[model samples]
Target: MSEQPHPPKREIFDVPAMTNTDNKGFLRPVDEYRQLPYGLYMSRPADHPRFHHLESWLLPALGLRANIFHFTPDHRSGQRLYLDVGRFTGPDADGRWYSVDWYLDLVDVPGTELELLDVDELFTAHAAGLLTLDEAVEATEIAVRTLRGAAAAGDIQSWLDAQVGGRMPWLDRPVAR
Candidate 1:
């Protein structure tokens, strides 16, 4: 069997130069695979691991059901604490899915939350071709009026504290199969 070639690493928007305003123009260079619908949301990011674990636990806890997650890139903030947002099935992996929710990383500082962009901007970008119809519809399901929030850090001790019962599940941590 032939080996599968790895996709080339492409540098996207500089990120820091972008602003938080809800402008459709921000959705330029409409590369559907890289920018539209679920494309942007699925990009691999620096904070993906924490978000993955958080999703693993939180989704089931909240009774939300979403096998897929859409973590959109800010591509605007220059700082380490850029705004991160996504959609998922509720806290339970089996529950109804939710979208356009914000995810914050407190980092080393306590009581600090990352700033997030308004959900409408996502839809505006979608309408402008930054996102696909599926992505746009999902954005509509989670409009600006109804936003959600979650927080995490490299260290999960605090994240565990915020859980409904402060319970730690073995599956949340790394395990060998």
Candidate 2:
């Protein structure tokens, strides 16, 4: 019997760090994990101080990223999407903010985009008990709107080209350098 070949590893994510915490996200403690825009993300531990926790990823790859779905306002259609990970907290959880992560691929899902927030932020948000279902919907809706608008105006293909900095079929137009 021949063995099946393994799928190529996705560079989008960095190698997992060795830590006492053994959480790896696919669909996790937070179903909303699938709702944040593209970036690394994690959920809060059962109990921790600060009420929120977030760590940094390896260099270069550090940025806001999310897994989101693209779709119409009514969610009549949907597509899986992502943005590069960006944003982090200071030592004492000073100012809180999220940057405009890069544009991610939008595979067909339903036209209703799901924004997967950065894992670290998700963890922090969940830990702080600041996360809410309504907020998740709003996040996803924002990404969906951005994607739809970019597709209409053609800013995304160029942005996508910049994100990969390589030639890809997804670009409907010739990406400018």
Candidate 3:
């Protein structure tokens, strides 16, 4: 396969400052941020056509950032969850979080059924030297592990609850219609 153009995907979560810097470097105000033992939680308004807001949990231990996009009624796609496989880290000295996306994503639809997306993008990015060998391998492993765990537990939420020892904050919020 030929190498395709792939931009670096990284995000900055500055909870103390209540700001989020998107991959494109646009700064957006955060509505809320909560630091949990397992990860950092962020809820922010999105200036997008399809979704007005989003809530995400950056679970570094699982190498997954789980997202709930509060989609507009016209754009509801029946996707329950979106998981990004990536290297996530945080709170170095400035109490900020970071994420480096690995070009692979998992979309949960209807229920626990997950459809992996962007495998070709991953391979193409790897070929283009955008991701190191270790990162590519790690992304693949995380995606596989998440799928297996969710399948075994009967749902993604169950698997995540087991991992974090309880339900996440996003679980309590009703999905915006």
Q: What is the TM-score of each predicted model, taking all chains together? A: 0.25, 0.25, 0.94
* lDDT tens digits by residue: candidate 2, 21-58: 22222311221111122222332222323222222221
The per-candidate count of clashes, in order, stands at: 16, 43, 0
Give per-residue CA lDDT, model 1, range 93-161, as digits (tens). Answer: 322223333221122222444333444555445555656677556544432212233333332233333
Top candidate (TM-score): 3
| C-alpha lDDT score of every prediction, in listed order | 0.30, 0.33, 0.89
lDDT, residue 59, model 3: 97
**Candidate 3 lDDT tens digits, 86-172:** 989987799999999999999988654888999989888888888888888999999999999999998887899899987777846
Deviation (Å) of 72 in candidate 1:
23
lDDT of 1 at 65: 16
Off by over 4 Å in 1: 1-84, 89-111, 117-124, 129-163, 168-177
Poorest 10 consecutive residues of model 3 by lDDT? 168-177
RMSD of 1: 15.7
